[model samples]
Target: MPKTLLDVDGLTVRFEVKRGSGWGKKSYLYAVDDISFEVKQGETLSIVGESGSGKTTAALAVARLVPAHSGTVMLDDGNVLEKQGEDLRQTRQKVQFIFQDPYSSLNPRKRADSIVREPLDNLSEKSEDEKTTIVAELFEAVGLRPEQMKLFPHQFSGGQRQRIGIARALATQPELIICDEPVSALDVAVQAQILNLLRKLQREYNLTYLFISHDLGVVQHMSDAIAVMYMGKIVEHADRISLFTSPRHPYTQALLSAVPTVDRTQRAKQKRILIPGDPPDPINLPKGCRFANRCPIAEAQCSQTEPELKDVGQGHKVACHLV
Candidate 1:
């Protein structure tokens, strides 16, 4: 069996939002709600969902960027949520993040080389010469010229900025890299370049990824396994081929339908499954099925009771009463 690099169990993160006026009560936002999943040693396990879904929030919780309200984020043998101070700092070295927005994530004030070397300067006890060598090697690995290192973030193109971010994330040689919609902000052509770079790095370094994205097309290209999130809950989980070919949950089916396909036969027969109704307010979520309001096949039972994510043969799991 493959060694599990990261194992998250019942991980929940809640945020307090004060609604409007002074008289109003503070309601909680369930950004990540009791979700559990794992990423194997060198594999990418993608968390794909809609805009409001808790995929990014869950990744943030795992990295301890945001506080996890309850549950465990097990990175190998250690539970990240339990770590404090120096231990937390050390845990952070093992896991790094590549943010979505290339333009904003990179430091505008710092030079490209400075931004990439920041992680090493903070996390490692290496000498200045060692850091320089590491940074130069990273620049070469990410397809950037050594001369470009002195330039500021703005000096680089959008795709080049993202490559710099990728180089920074790899500075500490992290075992698990959380890529939060890394290519979503780049152009279509640049998106492919970034995606290809990520795959090459993963192979070269044997890195594990918790890739979060709304684009199923990108997910299909990169993921070994996929988890479908809806309203902060994982409604479906399966291998990429299984999930794409046979989505059991209504929410997952609707999401996959929205991905544009090139197969002419499929395009001719496949009708876009439009989901009805907006997602339920996070503060006041449905007691039963969260997607019940928008599910085309939802029955009365779906509104009355929540369904467990049960295995329906093979390793495929779906959380729907009808499934």
Candidate 2:
């Protein structure tokens, strides 16, 4: 079995929101409310959810880009949250991020080569010649031409820019790459190319990815395991095949039902599961299950007590009263 590369436990991130007048009653918006999951070496674990589901916040917390209120993130057996100064800087090299918007992420002032080599320059003690050679190789690896390295970010199309972003993330030879909607900004045709490129690079470099996206179709294509989050908590987590074939949580079922399918048999077998009512206020969440109000088959007990995520069989875990 492949070793676990990243392990997150009790990760919680909160934002302070003041409602009333000056220094009024302060409330905490629990963005990521005590979620935990692990990604194995050389595999993708996707966290999928709708807008305001806190998937991005969770990813940001894992990378230490945002302050985690409380949690332990173990990356390659090292406690990421405990690292400081140079220690944290070194940790950054092992865990790089491919951001959502290629247009905004890249620097307009710098050339492609400099952008890609930035990580090597900052993180590693490589010679100038070595860095240059690495940048050239990275351009080739990510399917960019050698001559194009001199061009600015505005020179390339969206997809090409994303490839450059991927190259930058790979510059340090990272163990884990957090892809924050890596292909969402590209065209439909281009999205497939980038995703395939990422998968190819993963196989070539033995990279592990923590992919975050709201698109189930993209998640289905890229994920080895899937975790469904709603209102800052993971409602369900399972292997890709099991989650898609037999979703245990109501939220996961509703999510899968919305995915467009080409297969007629599969399409016919799926019924549209519409969740009614907006999610409860993050600052003042209900005491019971966060999804109880919206769940189709939620019982009286669902609103009285929160369900703990537990494995039914074959590593499939779900937090639901009626599962």
Candidate 3:
């Protein structure tokens, strides 16, 4: 097996919210609560959950874009959060981000090439000619024409803009790319194209990816491993085949049941597990299992005691009372 490229242990990110009046006490919002996972070299580990599940927050914390309240994010030989000054700058080059919306991510005034070259200019010590050559190569790698590089982001279609964003992410030549809902903003057709392009780039560059998305279908297509999160905590994690075939967690089973299969026969008979109740507020989370309120298999013990993630079979890990 390839060496682990990124190791995140007991990662937690909390936001403080005000409660009442003048001397209000701070309430903690656990955007990412004690989540731990690893991304191996050249592997894609996807984090899938509902909107408030903290997948994106976990990604940002790993990238050091957000302040982590606890835990460690180690990339290769160094702890990313511990670094300062030049070391931090260098660490950032090793990990890049691809935002969700191509339209909002790119600058409207800058040409496509300039936008792609921005990372190179900031992180690289290369000369002007070298930067230009590298940017052109990235554009080609992302399937964008050299001539189109001169065009502004506004001139391109939604799909084309996304291609430019991909080009920009590649410009840094990062070892790990955090794709936070990268294809969620694009049309269904365009989503496939972007996913394919990401796969191709990963093969060519031996890149590791932390792909964050709520869409299970996309996660199935792009991920080597899947980590299911609920209410700021990881509920299940396993290899792609095991996750899809024999999901151990009730939450994972519910998510898979909701995915639309192409087989009409199977689709017609499949029973969808409808989870009741809205997600609890992060600022005022329950003391026990965060997912207990909505989990169908949750018992009384689930409401009083939190379940620690335990390896059940092979490398499959689950944090639930039933598991």
Candidate 4:
């Protein structure tokens, strides 16, 4: 079996918000509430959910971009949340991020080569000659010409800017890459190109990814394992095949139903599962399951007590009272 590259346990992230005017009271907006998952070496584990479901925050915490309230993020057997100063800087060399927006992420002032070489400049001890050589290689690896390295961020198209982002992420030869909707901002045709490039790069570099996205179709293309998050909790987790073929959680089913199918027979068979009502206010969450109010088959028990994510059969785990 492949070694676990990233192990997250009971990860929780919250934001303090005022309850009323004039700072009447403070409450915690539980963005990520006791979520856990693992990403093996060379495998892609995707977290899928709707907007405000805390998927992005979870990824941010794992990357150490945002502060985690409670949890242990173990990357290559070291506790990331405990690292400080120089230790934290060193840890960053092993983990990199591909941001969602290519246009906003890249610096307009810097040339393409400079942008790609930034990570090596900050985290690597490579000499100038070595760095230049590595940057050239990265540009080529991401399908950009060596001459194009002189161009600014504005000179490139959306797809090319993302390629630059990919090259930058690869500069450190990171053990884990946290991709937050890397293709969502691009055109539909460009999204496919970028996704294919990412897969190709992963195979070549033996990269592990913690992917976050609301698009189930994109998750289906890239994920080896899938975790369905609803309102700051993981409701279902399983391998790609199991999750897609036999989703146990009502929330997971609703998500999968929205993905457009190309096959006529499959489209005819698939029915759209509509989830009613908006998610509960994060600062005033219910005592039980966070999704209880919206779950179609939620029982009294679902609202009375939160269900633990347990293995129903095989390796599939679900946190649903009905399941």
Is 1 or 3 the stronger prediction by lDDT? 1
TM-score of every candidate relative to the true structure:
0.97, 0.98, 0.98, 0.98
- Candidate 2, lDDT over the whole model: 0.94
Residue-wise lDDT of candidate 3 within 1-323, one digit each (tens)?
Answer: 89999999999999987788849666788899999999999999999999989999999999888999999998987889799989898888899999999989999999899999998898889899999999889889999888998999999989899889888888878999999999999999998899999999999999999999999889999999999999889999999999988899988898889888898986887689878889887888887888789888888999899999999989999998787
For each candidate, the alpha-carbon lDDT, in order, equals 0.93, 0.94, 0.91, 0.93
lDDT value, candidate 3, whole model: 0.91
Candidate 2's C-alpha runs over 4 A off are: none
lDDT of 2 by residue, 1-323 (tens): 99999999999999988787857677889999999999999999999999999999999998999999999999978999989999999999999999999999999999999999999989999999999989999999999999999999999999999999999999999999999999989999999999999999999999999999999999999999999999999999999999988999999889889888898998999999999889998888998899988889988999899889899899999998787
Question: Which candidate, 1 or 4, has the higher TM-score?
Answer: 4
Which is the winner by TM-score between candidate 2 and candidate 3? Answer: 2
- Which candidate gets the maximum lDDT versus the true structure? 2
User: Per-residue alpha-carbon lDDT of model 4 for 141-199, expressed as tens digits?
Assistant: 99999889999999999999999999999999999999999999999999999999999
lDDT of 1 at 146: 90
Candidate 1 backbone collisions, by pair: none
